[model samples]
Target: MKNSIFFTALLATTISLASCHNSNAKPVISNEIASIEKTSVDGNTKIQVALLLDTSNSMDGLIEQAKSRLWNIVNTLTTLKYNGKTPDIEISLYEYGNDGLSAEANYIRQVTPLTTDLDLISEKLFTLRTNGGSEYCGAVIQDATKQLSWGKDNDNMKLIYVCGNEAFNQGGINYKEAISDALKNDIYVNTIFCGNQQDGINSYWKDGADYGKGKYFNIDSNRAIHYIVTPYDVQITTCNERINNTYINYGSHGYEKKQKQAEQDRNAGSVSSANYAERTVSKSKAAYKNDSWDLVDKMKDDEKAIDKLKKEELPEELKNKSKEEIKVFVAKKSKEREAIQKEISELAKKRQDYIDTEAKKTKTQDDLGNAISTSIVSLAKVKGYSVEK
Candidate 1:
């Protein structure tokens, strides 16, 4: 039995089902986030994944599944270690086939570039809306391959997951040529057909996966995702709130960004308590870095970051303080954050152990999260990576 397929979903799986299919509904998250610069951490090895999701009227379930499983997928990826070193993991999202998008661009939008900002990823994931439009799989694949800043390191793991129910070869651009370009960059393209297995094969979904040297899966997108409640859940979620209080916000948009962090916490909980706990575990990991705004994390990348800050950039609490005073405050917050994260990490391990033991009693079903999580671990092993356990 696979480690992730069962234990993972109990941590995976939800979103506001009511508005998911509304074509005219506006994005729940603000679109004024353009001024924030996209940032990444320098690492010897990294794992980059691009999610190309179909947002046509009929594929609303697919979008919901992606939202429900985002944290679980992140947690699963964090378990991988390459030669005992944790690789920086970046996830990029793209939405295609939404009528609201520009037709000149083939109804596709690059929601975000690859980044380690898990909060930004969650914000974008929640804003995805479904509308009637054409799903050009080939074009989306080609754009993602060229647009995103894929790593050049030989050991970097690059992957693309395109999920849709439409015919694979629907657009002017040939799927074969697009996947070939992805292969040139050492990127594997996986296909998730939102229907029957044989139906997906009939639509050439399997061939697209084969052409890219990746896995192919078929799933019932409309089925509700199931989760396992654990005894450690309440304790872990309580820690999430305590950890949030440790973040010291800075910069012009510091306060708003901090609020967004709390909002994302609520969004995860809205899905289910299990998902909320999984997200807390992800926040405790290294990949959830927020150095761009959070002073605690910002100081890690540059110890003298306080010296570079303008008086106006400092938050209200730090405004009138001397440089030494500010440093002492940030140091205190950082220490608190570290202690809280440690507690959450330890609890997370116990939570997973409980999940694993209970999972053996039931059968596992393949959903968006399961398919991605299982493949991530398996592919990482093939690239000489190992699970921390």
Candidate 2:
């Protein structure tokens, strides 16, 4: 009877082990299925782009080319894939030379502010017309830098394409300063050098782009005019081919090793710990919790450090003894604060001046557009056709 009981216990243990293994295997399969679903959902990233166009009299053909190719550019961007992920691109257009007066006012008018609606962008592009003026690239950059809302979020990539036939260094504002500001705001400027100019002219634009952390394209005038419907194809295709070749040359084994290392870094525990610490510190500083005293302590320490560094410092007897001494210290501190406040006030005034200048320029541009539309209507009337505003 003892031998039969022991044999029954061993049989039950073996069945239980088999059932546990089957349950674990089912979960592994479910996790794999869920991962596949996630991969499909996270495939498309978004891009924000701006086109700074030159509407100078010399760019009539360039404008025509751009209109013809606008749809093609949108289609190409929509279809682009990097590492099996598509990029949804949004575009904005701004035309220089559209404003007939002061060159400073001829900057970007939001045309479209980063929207995925390609149809609307295309329609606006088609409406752009050429006018006569000197291209002030610095003004355009300054205008774009200040007016356009760019880089509001980290995931979006902002690009500016400055297309013009003239030299980009003509305006009073420094090109390097404009470019630096754009880079600070995370806006990349690409140059499309057009017209019958030497390669040296292209170099100037290239330098400006370098300052802006952008790429430069030297497009021959003839090519720009003739290849209107697909101005970017040759360059885009070449870039894509080079990228593919580089990836293939690196071999799958090498790529996998690099990818695994990246994954490990992303998942490391130290990163999570640092993020938690930051959150805790932020929460602890909330004023409603009566925690502002900690900030006051920091300020006191800062003031003590400054006092310790002073040369020919006031003797402790003089410092602590009289109301006159306390008054002098308080007055000195007040003066220092006043100086800082004055500097801030000056900066605010400068910013306001810039805004006022831009506002005046915008009014001029509006008037120019209205005048052009009116002139077109007049011409149509002379040709015996009814024109509608």
Candidate 1: 10-residue stretch with minimal lDDT: 1-10
| lDDT tens readout by residue for model 1, 215-299 | 9999999988888899999999999889998888898888988999999999999999999999999989988888888999999
Tens-digit lDDT track of model 2 for 1-389: 00111111111111111111121211111332222222111234444567777765666556555554453344324333433444445566666644433332442233444444343344455556555665677766666666554545544456677777677787666778777878887777767676433562554887876677666555444342221112222322222222222111012133443343233223321233322121122111111011011112123324443243222233333334354444455445445534433443344334334534655654332211122223323322332334211
TM-score, one value per model: 0.90, 0.43
- Candidate 2's displacement at residue 372, Å, is 29
Off by over 4 Å in 1: 1-37
Q: Give the TM-score (vs. native) of candidate 2.
A: 0.43
RMSD of each: 7.9, 29.4
